[model samples]
Target chain A: MPFAPALHSEWLKIRTLPSLAAGPAAVVLVTAAFTALAGLDESAGADSDPLFASLFGVVLGQIAAVTFGAQAVSAEFRGGALRLSLSAVPHRGRWFAAKALAVGASALAAGLLAGCASLAVGWAVPGSRAGGPNWGEGLRGVVGCGVYMALMALFAAGLTALLRSGVMTLSILVPFLLVVSFVIGGVSGTAADYLPDKAGQVVLHSTSDGALGPWTGLAVTAVWAAAALAAGAWSVRRRDA
Target chain B: MTSIDVRDLTKEYGGRRAVDRLTFSVRPGRVTGFLGPNGAGKSTTMRLVLGLDRPTSGTATIGGRPCAALDEPLREVGALLDTGAAHGSRTARDHLRVLAATHRIPGRRVDEVLEEAGLAAVSRNRVRTYSLGMRQRLGIAAALLGDPRVVLLDEPSNGLDPEGIVWIRELLRRLAREGRTVLVSSHLMNETASFADHLVVLGRGRLLADTPVREFVHARAEPRVRVRTPDGAALRDLLARHGYESVAEEGEGAGDRWTVRHARVDDIGRLASGAGVTVLELAAEERTLEQAYLDLTAAEAEFTAMSPSRAQEA
Candidate 1:
């Protein structure tokens, strides 16, 4: 496709990290674990859809996205290889764009596999008649989850560039996504709706609550992703490698 | 022809000036050695040229264009900032292949570079498993993958063994002969002295000397004639009469022995013969590059007196 060389280089980098393997592996394991949990629950209910129950793995799978996002740029900074990478591709903005594309593609692929596997396992289990969630809606949910994961990864990448430390990036992101959202949800009723996880999870629901339609939630997540990516791009372009 | 022109390049790190008004040009088809002590801003200058660091003032351009302006930078300039900069988990071949993919270079080119760098046997091995010398070779291979017109290497010999060092020296020379601009930086004066045709010497974040290697050696080196003779005092006196000072040999049983400072070989022979002292052996001792470098940077040495920290810093 004649994409920037930096993009190809970044894809190679993403594939090489031990953490990259961990992300997809985490997706599969978490999906299977959640599917088994849902299967064990005798009261999964006749009304409960298999897709929703099995796709519960998305919650845990998002953590993998966080890891992928952080490692995408954080590893370079930690290894002091940013200088080398920047030397290869001098245009800082273009380099970041390439990284975003490569990281996004990987996250999408992994998220889809996890989402599809969870759905398949849920449908295969006994006594779970709940299957029909409209093929289009289900497709949207799967695609949205992948996009959400990719965005989360980009968000993490930005935070890593700003923080410039792997531990610090993870420390800040984990709490914001996992803990702070829960705390805010408990403190204020409507705050969770705006949180990234909350907004992203809205895609999984086949029926729309008046709060935010599925597409609207995806847009909300996209806004968060765009903001984080913009901030990351700015930092990468302005700061010394 | 690909030439690197750096004009008044200055890079400030917070309050500290990493590179202060550094100006120099690396011409095509020459091995230009960048010489400096630790913290003399050799790496910083290179970073500026590659556009890895923003210059506070001035500019560094490759082939009349800023590095950032190049459409396919690797095809024009290949740089090795660090030998071990690749991801540890990736194989050496994969690292090179990924870089090759960037410029749409064929896979065959990657294999060629691997063979050229003598890394074909271990191309499949993980980078982390390679020794420092191997990593350096891999980096050189990556730099040469695009058949670049200009190659910028920073301390490429830092971790290499004697054989590897010689290999790099020959490789650089060959590359230069093939019309590529090869710029290599090193703090080791002797290493560059034998290999470099031109030199850009730096001290204390400033340019100290930029001249042909021959000129630098000739201007700074003071050749002395070494003689072994029983009547050393008579020869020393005869040389002293000709307006030269001599320092007596300082050791036990070293009777009447002395070494004259900066005495030319012909002058010593003539002075000894005129004084009736039979010179047992007389030969001109070519001044080593180490001596010349020490004399050149004595005043601006970062560490006036050596210590543990200085050793660690270097």
Candidate 2:
């Protein structure tokens, strides 16, 4: 079959499941709400990057993005779902690619919506708008957020496929994003900035002192996602359903 | 109509051979029973045919094409490996829709199958809320969604009530009547006997017997004659003289009753009549498919526990 039908099948699976369907909405709500709250906070330093603060909600929202990706693949492990899937579409590589594409598209759409909501909230809040980012920076942050969320979701998806368990993927990724990324960022080095989560988030910042620019940072994260996806596809092709 | 051809297919898991060099062909327009005892590699073989697992050796193909090579395989082959393959949170309709989408099968066909499986009223319910039988129906519905020419079902009658079993039996027959190749696996020979016209018996990952269902029973089970006669002793003596041994029946009417094995009813009647013995009742007892399957797989069962008394002795 052509890739479109496989992709359509994958899209149906995502939209039909309650937990999977809730992912995008959760991403938009959590990211927007947190970004609005952060915009309203009065304890900011004078030289704080307004764009990062406006899009700060992405840190929390990324959990939903990762979860969306993880569950898309992990659901297949439950009750021999993968067996059914493979029987329908026997080409494992094509199926995996379609699955990844569905996940990426959903997460990216949610990320863009979340980014716009966060920016709108920042403009609405008088305290945040006092030093808000210009339209060029805001536009970059919105587009960057979409690409960043898509890459993170793909990363989680690939990891889930490799691990063959959504819980295991979440256990590793959730902690890494919530704790390890920040802890490593605290250590002064350019290498820490290249970490998948940190590198992707650099695009949300209005100003940066790091060696990598916004697009390059996103590219670094994209490499991580690509590597994870490659590993996932290999696992799918090599392993029995 | 497509035929399933398996040639010396083998599959090994963790150094243990789940399916040995097994070969069988299922032709169109017939319901072939894939029979075996538990762990006799029936499921493994089906998985190999569907390309869910890589074979250690040999090949299985539908219409001369490997399952992986067929584009939109659902349109060519429909398989029901596990009833619970669908996500519990999704409704039966949605589960079928997901599979149907793969081959671009129309949404109307999904509803048609749901109705055909007698699950239309409950199609909107989440699979988690369904009974085992309902899930089974949903699985069958998904299998029929593409209206494929080849249907492979593993233990399809499991979790079904009597009426449901009968319903599935009729459905399999109808599928076969439509010139589709149907392979339904089961450990229960009696259940298989009710529907399958052909039998592919498996024992210890090896092909045991592949023939017509009736022929399998007739070939494996010893034919016996149940005779009740007033002069049973005289008849028994006459049969013994002809090198036929007869055992006395031990039930309520123990008087003048004999069961003769490996002897035709006509021969028994002729022997009795030649000796002027009066025969009260004489008939050939048909061996049930259950007995034939048990006799065939008696030594081939994967796990056979010793009797309680034998265990104590051991």
Q: Tell me the fnat of candidate 2.
A: 0.89
Docking quality of model 1: it rates as medium
**Residue clash pairs of candidate 2:** none
User: Tens digit of lDDT per residue, candidate 1, span A18-132?
Assistant: 6665765676667556766777677767666444665666766787787878887777785557876776677788888898888777887777777677666666766445455
- Model 1: share of native contacts present? 0.49
Clash counts for the predictions, in order: 1, 0
lDDT of 2 by residue, B19-90 (tens): 889988999999999998788899999999999889999999999999999987888999999887989999
Q: Whose DockQ is greatest here?
A: 2
TM-score list, all predictions: 0.91, 0.95
Q: What 10-residue stretch in candidate 2 chain B is worst by lDDT?
A: B305-314
Flag regions of model 1 displaced more than 4 Å: A1-6, A16-18, A42-51, A127-137, A186-189, A208-210, B250-257, B301-314
- Worst 10 contiguous positions by lDDT, candidate 1 chain B: B249-258
